[model samples]
Target: MMLEYLPLAVVAIVGVPLALAALTRRGDRALTRLALALFDGWVADRGRRQRERRELLYEVHLEDTYRMYASKTLLYAGLVALAGSVVGVYLAAGVLALFKISPETVRATLPQQLWFLADLLVFPDLSLGELFTLLAFSSATLGVAGGAITYWIRWENLSYRANARARQIDESIARTVAFFYALSRSGMAFPEIMRSLARNRSVYGETAEEVAVAVKSMDYAGLDMLSAIERLADRTPSQKFREFTDNLASVLQSGQSIPAYLDDQYERYREDAEAEQEAFLELLATLAEAYVSVFVVAPLLFITILVIMGLMAIGRTLPLLRVIAYFAVPLANVGFIIYLDSITESLRATREAREIDAAPGLLAGVRRTDDPDADRTGTERPAVEGSAVRSDGGERPAADSSAGLAFERLAAFERVRWLRDLLSNPARTLRENPVYVLYATVPLGVLSVVLRAWPHLVAGTLTVETLDDFVVQAALVVVGSFAVVQELHRRRIDAIEAAVPDFLDRLASVNEAGMSIVESLERVADTELGALDAEVERLRTDMAWGVEARTALYRLEDRIDAPVITRVTTLLGNAMHASSDLARVLRIAADEAQDTRRLKRKRRQEMVTYVVIIYLAFVVFLVIIGSLNSILIPSLPTGAAAPDTGGAISGGPLAGISEVDVEAYTLLFFHTALVQALFSGLVAGQMGETSVKNGAKHAAVMLAIAYAVFLLLP
Candidate 1:
């Protein structure tokens, strides 16, 4: 009877929350307070600290983000469970009806035994209605339990994300501290350095966001810089960041030299970072060994064993082999790859932007008086001012309209700039937006496939084999296009990266010789810096034509699109504002860039062997699969020869292959080889290069090799 009301019970469970919300609309704050009080009471002190760390790591407010998500998660999880319970009860009823499970028959079989148990529990004899009620209650209980478990899992996931964020922040702290040190050496105040760090969050990642939090407290919450640092120190998830902040606060309080403190911190962190890198490299080596043992050797062993079993016509050998080939090997490889990615994911080169900590009137105190044509100081003029007022007070375009005219030209240039870019630097354009390759590749590929499959389509009888051929051709076109484009793009970026350290060093030397940055840029722009010469020339041109030094530098950064350049630009731009003695800052940036380049070189050189191993492993896998399809399968006796007398062959006993489909096994081998080649190439690329995008070229190469081997060798 209770099961019949399952739908109504579920509706009531859902409606209660909506009704409560509607009724408490005017008392929302009270309800929120009540919820917080409940959660606060339930949370122990240790859990509270963890929650605080989670909140600070994610930069979420307690009142808004934390309480709201927690409340919503609980409410929604409960609702889901309630719905599950209703469904469970309804399912129970339907199942009982379908199976004709009569409670009377159950009782009749063991009435005395059941009644004795019921009497001991102080209940009357069990009936069908009571049984239904018990089942419904159990279903509801399970639903509620499931909901609670789900909420716990989600909460744990948030903690994991916070930990990841903390790791990234910790990784980048040394570089970030160096940036602060350099700016401090240039005579910028600590607060100003913090603000600069905040502004360049895109370049520095999570560490910058942490700095921005303090900047916000100082600027908006009326806290002194030292007090803000203290608050940040208390709340940050990273022990390293917390230590840095605590030391910074101590320096501020004790009146130690800020630059000296910063420099010491930078050097200390740099050493620690190097130590961490060595540890990381050691871990990667271990992972490589494990990947070989688990993904390569184990899979090979399994395949060999399964094949041998198949040759003897052992129990369901083909099905087991298929499971190993199609599921086990791939899944294990995927798991290994994910584990590699997780461990290698760095805090130092973290890619995402955090929430911006905006403080009102942040730049109100800064005064800019350098421009002669400006009617007012410290006010930004638009890139394009309404040309000029003629003597008759009418608007007309100015011939020498400074950068406003350049802005106008850009407005016009926007229409067909992509076409020009595509024609001129197609590789770079494709690299910046890889999806563009798909636009051309997808259409051409589809057309090629259509052309190839036209006859089959026209006859309206395309076999699976024909479809597979079309897919293979189309996939080759797509992957091949991406591979070609990405490889070229990678080469271009490598050339640019090679030139950056030298570029910065020379610019620093020139600036140190008493020339302004603009003058140094002009002097060095004409120097042959290989890949960087044209970019330097463009920087000079932008400044000469009345563009702000910062604007011109940023434009150069935009054109180059390398993280190293972005960091250098941000450092130089911010440092140039703090003092004219920017040579030291430039030198520091150059050193950091060199360090980054060295690390990349080291990683590539070390991982190259693993990449080679992957290729070799794939080759081995291909050889074995190829041998099976060509030699063993064909050599097997087939089709009704006295139940194919189990024979001894090649020093091993072989069972008659009575029912095995040679074609099916051959097709499976063909597909497995193709799949292995594709994934192995990807793994090789990822192991060699940090990016999976780099794997596309490897995939293409491997796929081509697979195609050649299967077609010619077979």
Candidate 2:
């Protein structure tokens, strides 16, 4: 009966909306007018009231908000309800079909007293199909009701996003204030400082986004700075932002010293930042202690208990331990790492933004074919000899070819040029983009494994041991090559950073002695500054060729791409534009850079102990697994008959363990050690250096040790 009516049910569900839509377009949209009338009478009141009470529609930047927006909102709500009802009917039917529910089964599943209540509520004397039909209808009604509630909740999300933005503004207030203070000290006008901060939206985050709005208003909307600022204060979600802007506007009106006001604000924010850092460190300490207790102590204790249970021939003991070691510990560690990263993320000093070319691909060695001269003409100018001839039947070698090379030469050059460039600077290229290492190592690793496994494949006797050996070798090759390249890049960056402070100090001294910034840079160009010497020469050459000192400094920042260098260069470069006397600022920037380096070193030193702790924990874990596999499991006696069925040692501690496989358990133990080594290395890197990339070195060490132990000791 249900199958016979299924086609009719589907048509009624689908055809009604499409028919209504068709009618709505007919008779000059009569159905649309009816919909609008229904919305005005029934739905408009609640939405209008909510919009006024919440101010959410305005916050979300919706225009002509109340009546028109309310009608649209209600229309969307109706559509959502329709979609949800249709989905709910199909979902309920599918569930009923899959589970085959009946009244008797429903009664058995329910309590005795609840069965009578269900029977009273139309379950009595109903067939299973009829009951399922009623259930589908009820589900559809609930889905429609849920859609209405969900529509209201979605509107509430606008307010939630507003509050989140408010919190982000609060978080970034210190750095924004610092940028203002630094620029003010260099004597840049207030408007220019605002524009500069606004331009660095990516570096300054939400604070820059808010400032960009005010800048837009000032520039495009014909508002003065004061008026635009006042508007910003009115519209911003953050109370702190409102207070700052309002106080700033008041100071501008009262004729107070603007620099003095900014300096005071910067000092206050700096103090708050220090307090927040202290609080964050306290929280980090608590989390570290918790990690030691939960992941370290709990997993070790559970594994030991599971091993004892396994000795007693307890079923499921090995599976439980495997789950805890392989899944639970790693997942918990990942969660802890994410938590630590969130709490430890503090505001950073704003840095200079690099200017990328309008079309970066044009600079990426891709040959351009869209030049008007080349496009209007059919072919490009040929550089290769014998590739072009004059149409007048005379050779014009001096004039050169107006058309490009023959297809053969172009294709030959294209093929070999890539290989030549790779061979020329392979180290630098691979260091810059380490993913290229996989292009070589992945195929090589797979080839190595395939070569070893080919004989086994031919014989149809590929054993687990042979496959494991191949996999281990492949893993070592891939990870080892990538780790070497990554470590080289990291060390190169570190050397550049170490040389930056001294280079800045020397430049400051020379410039203070009455030389121009260009002259000062030329003086320091040949100095022995480790990794920065060549970059300094490049800066000198850039200036000698008439690039502005500021632009040259920017180019240097781009070339190095270090955060500390970016901050220092941005500070000094901007100050140089405002005043020629940048020696004082340069010295300050140098000191700040050195201080930052010192802090990073201190943090690394403190976290090293924790890194060692993780390594030792992994070693202990491996030892326990090894002991269980080698010393304990093999010692258990295997009976010819079932040990629990009146065989040798029946009812002993080893009873029911007659089928345990020592070899399988040993393999599982070896793989568990390998996994723990990888996890512990990653954890160590994150804890010590605050970078999972830095953990590659630790992972390399741990993996090498594991592979050596399992391969050689056996």
Candidate 3:
């Protein structure tokens, strides 16, 4: 009867979290209401400091009251714990009995300090009453552990978010101050600047979020600007941000010139930003070294020592090595990567490519401004040469005679539009969306694995090694292909941004020299801007037809889609409206773009050392594991550690080993190296480019090396 319900218990244990995760992500308000209705009163009675700590959540814009959040946490965790207890009871009773592991064998294997795990591993023969007691004890223990862990993680995640947001603010506040300095010089009012910054939150990042908070208080809460600024100062985590707000409040109150104050603030923050970034780099360096020592070097040492010691003691230490290889090292590296990302996220340059819509007066502008012939022919006139539109805007005379045939041909051509696009440039789809590589590679990989496994299946010799090879090879193929596409896309975007500074400078110069927007674009397009030349020419073509200059800039930015170029175009588009000195605005935009490229180049140069460190650590790990597998394991006698009564070897490195599964040890070592390769590659990517997507190439390369090395080793 208990066994019958075990599957149900397992489902509840697994399904509850998945269902709750989906619900929480969707922000199901009904669930929130239900949780609050059930546990809100219980949560209200908690400690006072806990209630006070709710401010941290709101500061990071978590948007949940402590009452609702705590109630859900308690309610969800408690229910999950109930299911966990049931699962633990069944596992302790039915599952362990089914395994029927020998208690004597377990007792001899584990060391004295780890003897407790013997009971966990082996199901001892016991009286009915003692078994009941064990089941009951396991229920309570598992229940408590589950609830505590769930509740603690849920509560602590808010603090992590707050700290991460704070880091973002501190790192990017320099650019925010620069925007303020530029806008104030452009004669924008202080409040207008706040509103403008709030509108561009997508481009400006975390500082815009802080500014949005201030703007909300002023607009919706009826607070004065000084009061809002004071509140922001109190709430923000960055010392620089707080100081800037404090000074801003004083300037607003004293009626002092905002531009002059912002100028000083921008200059100070700009200089300080360099020092701050250097400090961040130092932090990354420390983390890289820590990762190598803890995750790479330490695991290697433990595995080596465990293999030797396990041989000496004649114990089954394979379980211990399995934990380090499969769970500890990989999970710790992923967590470290996430933590690094959280801290350094704001430092990474982020971009948004917004589509610029045509103006409401676009048609009116063409008729009134561009087309002097509009009064004569409001119908259609040639705006530019080679437009491909007929001069009279009428169909050809032959169209009337063979209209049906023409329509049939057009319909047939339209049906194959997708084919034309896909085949025109075969890699175009992959270029636009790198992940599409999976669509082609995943099926091919699966088929290849299936074919490789079929012969083994027929022969009934399909061992684990063959299956493992198939999976590893498939992963390399699929991921390697995707990495190639992602890398190509990344390089193309970088090339576009590299040329943006020069393009903007030339556009500004030509426009300031009394050329119209169209003339400036035409002239700029003639100059070589590397990958951006074609895009610039298209912009000229757009403006040459009656699209406004600002609109054309929008399209150019939308196509480029790089964060730096996005920011530059956004600044240019907005500044053009506010100031007549387009030249000055363009100069500032150019300077900002150039600064971003310089910073990125510097970051890559600095990060190369850490990337090298990670690879070196991985190589060291591989060489040691490989040498142990190929050299030491083969040389040792099978019963070397059994006893001095039968064995010639004694009191040396291979002393006192009983019967050991050398093949199992080799296989485990192979797996550990592969796991290390995958994570090491990801960390290297994160260190070098601040992105996991960028690390796939490194990961695939390292995995291939590990796979090839292991094949040669054993």
Model 3 lDDT tens row, 473-513 = 99999989988998998999889888888988998898799
Report the lDDT tens digits of candidate 2 across residue range 1-714. Answer: 698557547647654664665465463244345556778665445655664534555444443345544554566567667666766776666655745556677687654435764444332355888977776786678667866876687566667767767766776776677667667777888888888777666556677778888898999998999998888888788888889999999987888888789778866865665565456445555655666667766777777787776666654577887787679877887887776555334333434333311111212211233333110112333354654467988775642433233344455665686588789999767876667897999999999999989999999999887898898878878877887887787787778889888998998899899998878889988788899878888877766665667666766776665667766766675576577766766766676567557656666776776777777776777677667766776666676643355644565566656667656666766776777677677767766766666677788788888777777654
lDDT of each: 0.72, 0.68, 0.76
Ranking by lDDT: 3, 1, 2
Candidates' TM-scores?
A: 0.77, 0.69, 0.76
Clashes of 2: 5
RMSD of 2: 9.8
- Cα shift from native, residue 660, model 3 (Å): 3.4
Model 2 CA lDDT for position 664: 67
Worst 10 residues of 1 by lDDT: 351-360
Model 3 TM-score, 2 decimals: 0.76
What is the C-alpha local distance difference test score of candidate 1? 0.72
Which candidate has the top score in TM-score?
1
Query: Can you list the residue pairs that collide in candidate 2?
Result: 380-403, 380-404, 381-404, 382-403, 382-404
Worst 10 residues of 2 by lDDT: 356-365
